[model samples]
Target: MQTQIKKWGNSAVVRLPATMLAQLNLSVGSPVDLKTEGDRLVIEPSLNREYKLSDLLEGITPDNLHESIDWGEAVGREVAA
Candidate 1:
């Protein structure tokens, strides 16, 4: 499939067809990485991985834990310890 790059404000943009996006499981506002491979332009989904709170907490251990620092006495209406 071929697409035309059109001028959008000061940037050139290509409108991908809905069918193409659906095939790739992508939609509007989806993160994507664009790069040039040789003479062809390549567009792929970003490799950003989402982390779960539970999974992150499981990775914490006493070996990597640190003690909290005391920031002196609170002058304003801060929560008391």
Candidate 2:
């Protein structure tokens, strides 16, 4: 689809069609990366790293673990038992 670039405030903007946006699963406020390759402009969804639980727990062992803290008693206000 062809879109004309129009001036919006101090920047030039090209509106993407609803169909294109749907195909790309992009919505308003979605982050996008833009770059110019030679004379061509490339637009893509910004990459976000989604870390796995295993990866986050990597290298974590009991040897490096700290003892759990215990709140001895409810010194402040206490609710019904």
Candidate 3:
């Protein structure tokens, strides 16, 4: 399928067909990664990962909740207790 590259303000824009977009599960405001492979333009979903609260705290339990760290004395302007 051929598409036209139209002028958008000062840059060129190629609008993807609705069918193609639907096939890729992409809708308006979806993030995508674009790159040039040799002479081809490749578009892929962004690698940005989204996690739920449960996913982030899965391995954290009460046993490790209050684990202390030996972060040596603050060298900067820190208020000493």
lDDT of each: 0.94, 0.90, 0.88
Per-prediction CA RMSD (Å): 8.4, 9.8, 11.5
- Per-model clash counts, in order, read 0, 0, 0
Q: Over 4 Å off in model 1, which ranges? A: 49-81
Q: Against the true structure, whose TM-score is highest? A: 1
Please provide, for model 2 over 1-81, each residue's C-alpha lDDT reduced to its tens digit, 9 standing for 90 to 100.
678999999999999988888999999889999999999999999999798999978968989977989868787777456
Error of 1 at 3 (Å): 1.3
lDDT per residue (tens digit) for residues 44-74 in model 3: 9787789899987997989878778888979
Model 3: residue 38 alpha-carbon error in angstroms: 0.7
Candidate order by lDDT, highest to lowest?
A: 1, 2, 3
> After superposing candidate 3, which stretches have Cα over 4 Å from the reference?
49-81
